[model samples]
Target: MRLELSTMRRVQRNPPCDHIIRLFEWFYTEDQVILIMERPPNSVTLFEFIKHSKGHPTERAAKVIVRQIIVALHHCNVCGVHHNHTHLRNILINRDTLQLKLIDFGGARLIAETPSEERTLGAVSRETAVRSGCECLYRVLCALIKGIPFWIRLSRECTDLLQELKNDRTWNTLENILDHAWFKEASTVNRGERN
Candidate 1:
């Protein structure tokens, strides 16, 4: 039943992550379910890139990838959805252009709204719920920038950011975070390293 629901949601939701492959069609047979999605051409996972190139990805390339991911995440959060298992492998890159698209939403969850009174320690303010989502975005970008292992990084960042969303004091919205000098500085550092 859970599988059935997941399959249905996959077809129905049309999640906004362009990096993620969208489910175009689905069917249920007597014994199983079949799902069809658009196949990316010459796709490579970020994990493969890290493995092949070792831990050092050019800072420029990393920033481009991270920026695209943040954009996608920003969109997802606006729609009240969160991908619980975002990681390097879930991001697919075009070999020619290095364009990134987030993929795989089997672990996505609809973010529940929290009451202002429920905001606890480490929690961002009610007005900053969007910023809490951005923190999640930052954690993933930071992990990639630092060359942290995908699985370990994703687990730690997701857990920590989710906690922060549930409890931070100075939380701002996603737009505010993106506008901050710190994010620009980090991105610039990454870009500089590429050169």
Candidate 2:
């Protein structure tokens, strides 16, 4: 609860992205804290979305969703909010618009804070969560697009990034990952829209 409150306060001061789940208000008693949050109607978890889609989303659809997730992560990092749990289940998508909202901040932490042995809502560290989470999503995209196992057609870039993540040689920052060709193209579109 302390972590969630502190993180929300920081984000409230420097709002991250429209894609994040908005916390409207909170009240606390001696034993419990209740947060009133904005719930998107007719939403489903990314896990369910993928499952219902039969493990396939169109290339363009996947691109749109992935870009939004990347943008949200970039905002989090800039605000020093580390989403220590970034699995598909934590992401919600509208069935019609396909818009995304990242939820479940129970594992969130400040990046600058010193690491302690305390258990988070998830067991993974911040760095590991980001790397593994992004990699898994990327692989899922590949699997969906190609109709084959991801390992069968791992691109050089994917291989390199996965290797770096496994070896613990690189942090694979969201901004850096966004620099990849696919994401760079998406970023260009976003900038054009803003301009």
Candidate 3:
């Protein structure tokens, strides 16, 4: 609770952003702390959304969602907040507009508090995550593109890029991942925008 409060306070110092959940107010007692948070109507966890969507989203739909997640991460990083924990369960997505809000900062760390060596280790872990395509961003990618059986509905460019992430000697940074051609491909449709 204390960690979350500190992270929220750090973010509160920054300019307003649409990606992170807004913290309206907070207070604490001896035993408990209270946080007033913005609750978007008709929003559900990304975990629930994926489960309801039959275990995976279409590539185009996944791109939209991933894009927003990336934007949120970028915004948080710019605010010196490193969300050490990012997963489906931690993200809230609106069913109607497909807007996303990252939540649960209990394990968040400020960039300055993190040592340079640890950041390098994080890069190594990122490589491992990409190699397996099962952690970090690749987990979502594998699930979304490969479906339940972990195969099918994959495009050539995307496959190659995933392979690059796995086989490349040097690990790619998050920004580089965003710059990849696969992510830059023209959006074919906004399939996830539910009525």
Instruction: Show how many residue pairs clash in every candidate, following the order shown.
Output: 10, 0, 0
Give the CA lDDT, 0 to 100, for residue 167 in model 1. 61
State, as a TM-score between 0 and 1, how close model 2 is to the true structure.
0.70
- Model 3 residue 136 CA deviation in Å: 1.5
Lowest-lDDT window of 10 residues in candidate 1?
A: 186-195
Write one digit per residue (lDDT tens) for candidate 1, span 1-195.
334336335434544456556667777888776777677888788777666664565445555676676666666555555555567787787766777777676666555566543344222333444544555555655555566433322233334433543464354445444454433643234222324
Q: Write the per-residue lDDT of candidate 2 for residues 1-195, one digit (tens) a residue.
A: 867876765655554577788888989989877887889988999888877875445545666777777777767766767776777788899998989998878878676433553254333355654665566556545444454333344334444544553455554566676566554443222111222
Q: Is candidate 2 or candidate 3 better by TM-score?
A: 3
Ranking by TM-score: 3, 2, 1
Query: What C-alpha lDDT values do all the predictions have?
Result: 0.55, 0.65, 0.66
lDDT of 2: 0.65
Q: Quote the positional error of residue 20 for candidate 3 in Å.
A: 1.7
The numbered model that scores best in TM-score is: 3
Candidate 3 ranges beyond 4 A from true positions: 54-56, 113-135, 148-152, 165-173, 185-195
**Residue 5 in candidate 2, Cα distance off native in Å:** 1.9
What TM-score quantifies how close candidate 3 is to the native fold? 0.74
Q: Estimate each model's TM-score.
A: 0.61, 0.70, 0.74
Give candidate 1 misplaced runs (Cα > 4 Å).
1-17, 54-56, 114-139, 146-171, 182-195
Clashes of 2: 0
lDDT of 3: 0.66
Please give, for residues 70-189, the per-residue lDDT of candidate 3 as tens digits: 667666655666777888888898987789888888877665433574575332233333322223466665555654234444556566656765565353435555776668766233
